[model samples]
Target: MIRKTFAAIALCAVISSCKNERRYDRIENAKWLIGRWENDSRAGKLVEEWSTFNDSMIIGSGMFVTGTDTVFSEDLWLEQHGDSLSYFAKVYGQNNSRKVEFKMTSSTKDQMVFENPTHDFPNKIVYRHVQDSLIADVSGVSKGQPKTEHFAMKKK
Candidate 1:
């Protein structure tokens, strides 16, 4: 009986550690996003910059500029929370200037998808790394109509 109990406890410990490692690995896999990315188009210049904040978090900033005027900006964060990873965005002049939370629902070696179904718009956000570029997609229902925006940016 004593041996059986000890074996069970050891197995549980190993399983718990593996779960934690997998959670942390999600953040580690996003290390490719730790750089500056930019997209210049007829509409404006979109810029996104990301950096490591700590062992389990990454901080980012995004901006859209037209000519010499700054039109929009936002603060971004990707953080690990226990068994999950979440994405947070605090956009200027939006949601009463409060941060919105999106839980990571799917991930791969070079892609991650976060979703917040309760949000007014952009219930889904996806980030993908391809070659030397990053592609970001945001989509959801707005005004009872579906809308989606795609951004392809090169590492700067």
Candidate 2:
């Protein structure tokens, strides 16, 4: 009887500990990402805009402009789908207008990371808020080699 009681108590303790893990509100945690960010790089002058469209969605856009030409542009969004959230991007001239989606893997007050291993190029995307600057990174393997791109954006 004592052995059974001890086993029951251990199971209860294990369950309670699991329940104590913190649960974060993904959208609320990402509130810091809203705003306009811009930077000048070798690619061109890049401008990224983010805003809250609804309680469950944040919309964003990015463009690279240089010398009277908009070289590239993309639309981005974070939305609650089903019971979870995802990141979506539609590059103006990529994959025939099909939006690529990355499922959010983890998030915190100042950081969010998403991953889609099946994507051809970028399989991971990370966004981080750092001291009035936003740092974004996309990384994956290509041609049997690892590659990454970083965007350092300042709020405007």
Candidate 3:
């Protein structure tokens, strides 16, 4: 009798885990972003062109026009991890690069937002998914200062 009882409990545990299964369906449409995007607006401008085959390796050029004297150039890479999305980028001359990892927090037909926590500046990095759309917004102060920037992307 005790053996049967233990077997039932084990089966229930397995069933519960299966019920909470998740998939990477969000990446199905992400192919639209795999190509390139360009934006040249007064508010913000950017150029990102690349080819990501199978989401394995990605190579691209990125440009950001912020202040009158600041023109930032960088590279981009996208990686797939089960149900999560990730990106790696490098500044033109910065010794260290940045890796952004976050699951698809929220998404819609025309909009999507991915979030990640940070310990450096602001605690949140929100990415907007859209054509000719903004990608990230930086809003945090290091030490009694202001730090905010907006990133936009558009298909070229």
Best-fitting candidate, scored by lDDT: 1
CA lDDT, every prediction? 0.95, 0.88, 0.60
lDDT of 2 by residue, 35-135 (tens): 99999877689888999998778999988899779989999999875557799999977879989999999888788999999997799999999988999
Q: Show the lowest summed lDDT stretch of 10 residues, model 1.
A: 19-28
Model 3 TM-score, all chains together: 0.55
Cα lDDT of model 1 overall? 0.95
Query: Model 3 over residues 1-156: C-alpha lDDT tens digits?
Result: 999999999999989777544344445545555566777787556777767555344456677666564488877655557766655556655645654443346666654444445544543445456555547665556686768767666566
Best by TM-score: 1
Clashing pairs for model 2 are none
Error of 3 at 73 (Å): 2.0
User: What would the per-residue lDDT of candidate 1 be over residues 6-103, giving only the tens digit for each residue?
Assistant: 99999999999997778677789889999999999999999999999988999999999999999999999999977699999999789999999999
